[model samples]
Target chain A: MSTILECKNLSKAYGGKTALSHVSLSLNGGHIIGLLGPNGSGKTTLIKLINGLLTPSEGSLLVGGHPVGVESKRITSYLPDQSYLNANLKIKEIISYFDDFYNDFDKARAYDMLEKLSIHPEAKLKTMSKGTKEKVQLILVMSRRAKLYILDEPIAGVDPAARDYILNTILSNYEEDATILISTHLISDIENILDEVIFIKDGQIVLNSSVDKIREENGKSVDSLFREVFKC
Target chain B: MAWNLNSDRPIFMQLIEIIQISIISGKYAPGSKLPSVRDLASEAAVNPNTMQKALAELERSGLVFSQRTSGRFITEDVAMIEDLKSTLAKEKMKQFLESMRQLGFQKEETLALMSKFLKGDHS
Candidate 1:
């Protein structure tokens, strides 16, 4: 598999406070990678950098062999930690909005997920619960056929059932060769879906290896290992 | 079918064992088509690469075979399944005896106890 995203000595600074230090890693295609860290550890910053929302302060950040720009944006589908869509729009309208915005958005896939989740596209986003809105947002994001999907805290706030639905939608969708980089502190929930995990702390990568390697060598799950590594 | 996995062990190893049990126990009947790697991965809630590796291992062991144009299928050989079942039982009994030995019981006494349990003893 080819490399989809590569970061070399990538750093981010706002004013004098550095949110991310010199972090370096290269991710290959056809993988579900966990970008795991506690809160305020620059997971969101790294995701934003990959999504082209912020420029790296020092080093190279590439998506599909090119720097973060129009090309990278075209290939990367991003879901931020907070809600980004308008609450005033109906679900159907939001679907159309995404359809107009991203060329890779698959309308059929989105509708299929909506139907399965029993979400009415005609219903107003404001009328739904927070979990339902999150599900809607997730469905829209996963329906894209992008090369790289950078999801920030995708399963944090949702209930267990919705989390399963979101994970299933994610697994069932996406191209086989595309890569998914999901950032979250909820390690146990998403650990099963991940092929590899990159454990970051204070903006530095602490561990990067295959899940099987970690389990076989340490005889523990990623969640337990995470607790041991990041114990406060 | 649902896949039950413990976070303590390697996923590929558990996946191979569970899938083998399914095949041998007729949950996935002989000569039947198996799910695609992606669907199976999603069903098992594990990585697709891991599922692919397990299937490849099964294929190597003659429990599974693939048709290039279509997909993988369980072996139609009932003898092979029976052979695997016996092998698994032997492994289980060996482990059982080892645990009994750890509890300070000899093999003969353990067999006698097992026989008594199987004999419908109330006490």
Candidate 2:
């Protein structure tokens, strides 16, 4: 398998606070990888660095063996933890923006998802509920045929029904050769879809392994292992 | 019913079992087209790659066959289905016998107890 994302001695700090420390990991294409960590454990920091929104303070982070820049950004479709779509823009306009920005964007697919969810193209984001807005944003992100997908806390703050919808959409839509890195602390909710998991705690990687090996050797579910490992 | 996974085992193995159950139980009828890998994955709420791996295993076992462009279909051979059904039954019966033996019941006594229960004659 081709290596999609690689990090070596990657560290990030904000003033005196260390968000990530000596994180070295490599991810290959064609798998759903879980970036598992608790709140403020540098999940967002790592994702941002990969997307070129933040620079690593200490070491190298490579996407397709290229440093974070335009090429990497072009291939990476990112869904940030917060909404980045303009509130005043109608759903169609956001679709148009993505279509213009990404050569791989499939407008029809995005519209198809919106239609399935009963979202009108003319509806403005400002008028929608938080969950609705999030769904729209997700549709936009998943519509792109990018090489890597970085979804930050996709299921957080959503009801169970909505979470199911989100997971289903992701499972059904992503490109075959693409690698999806979903960062969330909700291990149980997203555990089934993950091929491998990377457990981060206090700005460092603790465990990184395939999901099956963890289960076969440990005789425990990922959720159970996560709870035990991160017990307070 | 939608597939459910136990976290302590490899998903590929569990998926193979679930898909086999579906095939033998007639949830996917013989010769009928199977859902695309992505559709099945979404239905089972699993990754498509894992689902594909399981389906490939099923194909290798002759329980399913794939045409390059037309997608996969359940095996059309009735004998194959019957074979799988008996194999599954044998597995269940063996497990039951092992448990009964662990409880110190001889084969004859276990058979008697099972027949009594099957007859619904408990009073």
Candidate 3:
């Protein structure tokens, strides 16, 4: 497998405070990895750096062997923690916008997912419930056939049923060459789907290993281990 | 059968057990084509790589086999399936006896209780 993401001594700072320090990581393609940490543990900082929203204050980062730039942006799809969609636009209009923006966007696949949820293309985003809006946003983000999918807390704030839908959508979508990096503290909910996990704490990587290896070697689940490692 | 995996053990091992039980129980009939790895992974809500590892173990154990063009299939060896079924049953029986022993029941008493329960003697 190819190295889809690589970070060398990556660090980020906000004025006087350090968010991430010397965080070196390498992610391979064709796996679902969990970027797990508590709130303010630099999960978002790492994601932003990879998405080119923020430049790393120190060290170098690369996606698909190239530095984070237009080339990387073309192949990376990011779903931030907050809602970035316009509430005034209808679902169909959003689909059109995504299609116009992303060359790899599959409009038909997006519509199919919407129809499965009974979400009408004419329905305005503001008229839908939060859960439905999240679903729509997820569908739009996943519609792109990008190489790397960086999802920041995709399952947080959603109900169990909707969480299952989101996970299933992630599983069914994406090609064999793509990699998905899901950032969340909800480990147990998504542990079953992850091949590997990176535990971040206070902006530093505390653990990075395959989920099965962790369970086999420690005889404990990743969720339990996370609690033990980051316990207050 | 559903994939009821726990977080305590390696998921691939649990998958092996589940598939083995399914095979011995005739849920996946002998010589039947197993679903694609992708389908199995999605249904089980697991990483395809993990599912692939489990399937590879099953294949190595002679319970399952794959054809380059057709896909994976259960072994047609009825005798081998029967042997596996009895092995699994014996393992379960051993665990039941062990638990009964822990509950302070002697082997003979446990056997008697088991027979009585088998006869529908609820009282």
The estimated TM-scores of all candidates read: 0.97, 0.93, 0.97
**Model 3 lDDT tens row, A1-232:** 8999999999999999999999999999999999999889999999999999999999999999999999999999999989988999999999999999999999999999999889999999999998888899999999999999999989887899889878989988977889999999889989988999999999999999999999999999999999999899
- How would you class the docking of model 3? high
Between candidates 1 and 3, name the one with more favorable lDDT. 3
Query: How close is each model in CA RMSD to the real structure?
Result: 1.3, 2.0, 1.2
Per-residue lDDT of model 1, residues B19-41, tens digit only: 99998889999999999998899
All models, DockQ values?
Answer: 0.82, 0.77, 0.85
Q: How accurate is candidate 1 locally (lDDT)?
A: 0.91
Q: Give the best candidate by lDDT.
A: 3
Q: Which ranking of candidates, highest DockQ first?
A: 3, 1, 2
Candidate order by TM-score, decreasing, is: 3, 1, 2
lDDT per residue for candidate 2 within A88-192, as digits (tens), equals: 999999899999989989999999999999999999999998888889989999999989999998888788888889998898789999999999988888888
Q: Model-by-model lDDT, in order?
A: 0.91, 0.91, 0.93
Q: Which segments of model 2 are wrong by more than 4 Å?
A: B98-106
Which of the two, 1 or 3, has more DockQ?
3
Clash totals, every prediction: 1, 0, 0
When sorted by lDDT, best at the front, the candidate numbers are 3, 2, 1
